[model samples]
Target: MFRTVVMIFFACVAGVATAEDTRLKRLDTGDDSRGWEAVGRLDIGGKGFCTGALIAPDLVLTAAHCLYDSLSGAQINHEEIEFLAGWRNGRASAYRWVRRAVVHPEYVYNGKVSADRVRNDVALLELHHPIRNTTVVPFATDQRPKKGDRIGVVSYARERSEAPSMQEACRVMARQSGMLIMSCEADFGSSGAPVFSFQDGVPRIVSVVSAKAEVAGHKVSLGTQLEGPLAVLKAALAQGQGAFSAAPAPRENRITVGTRNSSSGAKFIKN
Candidate 1:
């Protein structure tokens, strides 16, 4: 599915050969995960999960597809979602329930792998309460990086779902139709992971993981550029598009790695 999508785009544009990829380092200990407390795991409907990051004390940035059910093509109830900030080894720096969620208006979840779907596959999640922990500072976002630029990714995935892993260096292989093809390692449970660009030694978000794909037998991750879509999501939130009814009290035992279901919404590209 992804191969066909990427191949179509690659035929029209040239992509740089991937540079030496960086190995993922697990952040299992506090010392290793400090300053990265904003990246968390999103548990959805007790059926699966995805990666997410806090952009504001109350807003989380993730892929739009993460808010839907892959099997039914239906939006999951916001109350069924929870954000476990800086989740690692059965604990989290902060826990919050999703009070509201807003997907990009242009994004359509038709269960297809297309540039249009991946381009607008971004979402903003509003937490019921802000995370005011001093250690879990929210991350700021920057404009999208260019092709061949060095970037990083911190995400929770299949085998390492209990902890987040950082791939300190990866290259943007190509940019086409508002989508990015990156050499970062991503897999099931890695959707909505924040793609970071370190400028002057400070990390800022530039893209959101939409799906994982293969190009010429090489594994690559798909991402959405944040400049326009983020603004749209914020505007929708301000206009009360994300508002929801009263939510139930938060729970303590909702942290788990996302398991693959019928559609693998946010994680995999379907044919």
Candidate 2:
């Protein structure tokens, strides 16, 4: 009976992706979403987009504004950017690519300020050469997992001054609203991190880390649901020839949460 139970336990664990009981640092209590990748720098030779996992190889999901011209509402600017998988120093070399970028048609920056910021702060770039590296964790398509749901997040962000020299946080956090906002402190460079939920044993992205803000003097982050963009990106990824493509129209864009902007403070419903 013990052996049978052990086997069943292993089966259940296998059906669910592994997650750590990641400790909470100086946090006000929130979910931990781990879906992050390092693409290129964030300036001229620097910035383009911060990458995160999407289901398969060749496709990378990120912010829409990363690819557009902030001023013109034109098209993608950067030609080639490096995609680093697992993004460790010596283990794997970064993948270089001329990209294929797509932004949702509904993505529009506020015309008053910059066109691109409103253009849609999300995008999917298909690599010039398919990456034969790293596991491409799939996304949760359209379903939004509930609060207190354990989620995993991974990212290769700005390495600050420390022995680890890197600011990397894994483990999971409680979810808030329809959005999964974590108190994980990410910098400007970590913008497009993928937020994954280890549900039914597979790692699936439920949302993409979209913004960070100060709420009541505490740091908090937010991600729009993955379903909207993932649907469009999947269809575009299958195509491979366009600069950009999106799913059918009437797509509900991802939600926006912050201190005083769209959403009020966040709350989780115990399930």
Candidate 3:
């Protein structure tokens, strides 16, 4: 069953690390996952992987694009997706298959970068079972951070796909047209990584990595603000519009990747 409440609370209290002096630390060892057990790698049918965060024991937050096949552009089956919590050094605290997934109602998999697309590139994955381990705690979702606010990201990217990396020094460079331009470094396979804002000395997810772009000669990561689109996605899931059930779903019209090319303010590099 779907979890009614999506928010989560951790047991212990740790002061939020400031982004001023923090640098990206690769979690190649078990000790590196002490405070980031909830962040995981979402493997899409062994084709590709994206970063995801646990908002509820059964719910994973990631980019909507991660649910689609990169070559066929069709929505992948939930059974093909798996979430590996606290993945580091070739191990994980927990591994579970996805039962269902719901994308933002307004999101269109058009293979293009636009304000509207970036604004709604969020998705929620329902896990087959909840990860209730003592260490693998889910994170809480919060409102979008204001412009220039210090934010952090834990992600698995192209070169660093084996282990996740924590970048606590990233900042929200700008918020325009409902999208967040962040200084956080993102690359291929980093799509759907959570953008966290520290609240009450805890990490709360505010946005999700969608793409990496160059803005005004400055390379920045693009993210979808979670305030509005997340609600719509939850509603869709409540209505059973975009979720998998016991029976298999009919195949959707396949859309190929990188079909639409838009040369605008941000150069859309799929991450």
Candidates in order have lDDT scores of: 0.81, 0.45, 0.75
Residues 1-271, candidate 1: write the lDDT tens digits: 1112332224422344565757899999999999999999999879889999999999999988887766666677878899999999999999999999988877877666666678888999999999999999999999989987899999998888999999978988777768888888788888999999998989999999887876656667889979999999999999989864343322223112134321212223344
RMSD of candidates 1 onward, in order: 8.5, 13.1, 9.4
Best by lDDT, which number? 1
lDDT accuracy of residue 246 in candidate 2 = 29
Sort order, lDDT high to low: 1, 3, 2
State which candidate, 1 or 2, has the greater lDDT: 1
| Candidate 1 wrongly placed segments (more than 4 Å) | 1-9, 12-16, 244-271
Candidate 3's residue-wise lDDT over 95-176, tens digit each? Answer: 9998878887667665655666777889998888999999999998999998778899999987887789999878877676
CA shift of 123, model 1, Å: 0.6
Best-to-worst order by TM-score is 1, 3, 2
In model 3, the runs with Cα more than 4 Å from the true position are 1-23, 244-271
lDDT of 1: 0.81
- In candidate 1, the residue pairs with backbone N, CA or C atoms under 3 Å apart (3 or more residues apart, or in different chains) clash, namely 49-258
Better of 1 and 3 by lDDT: 1
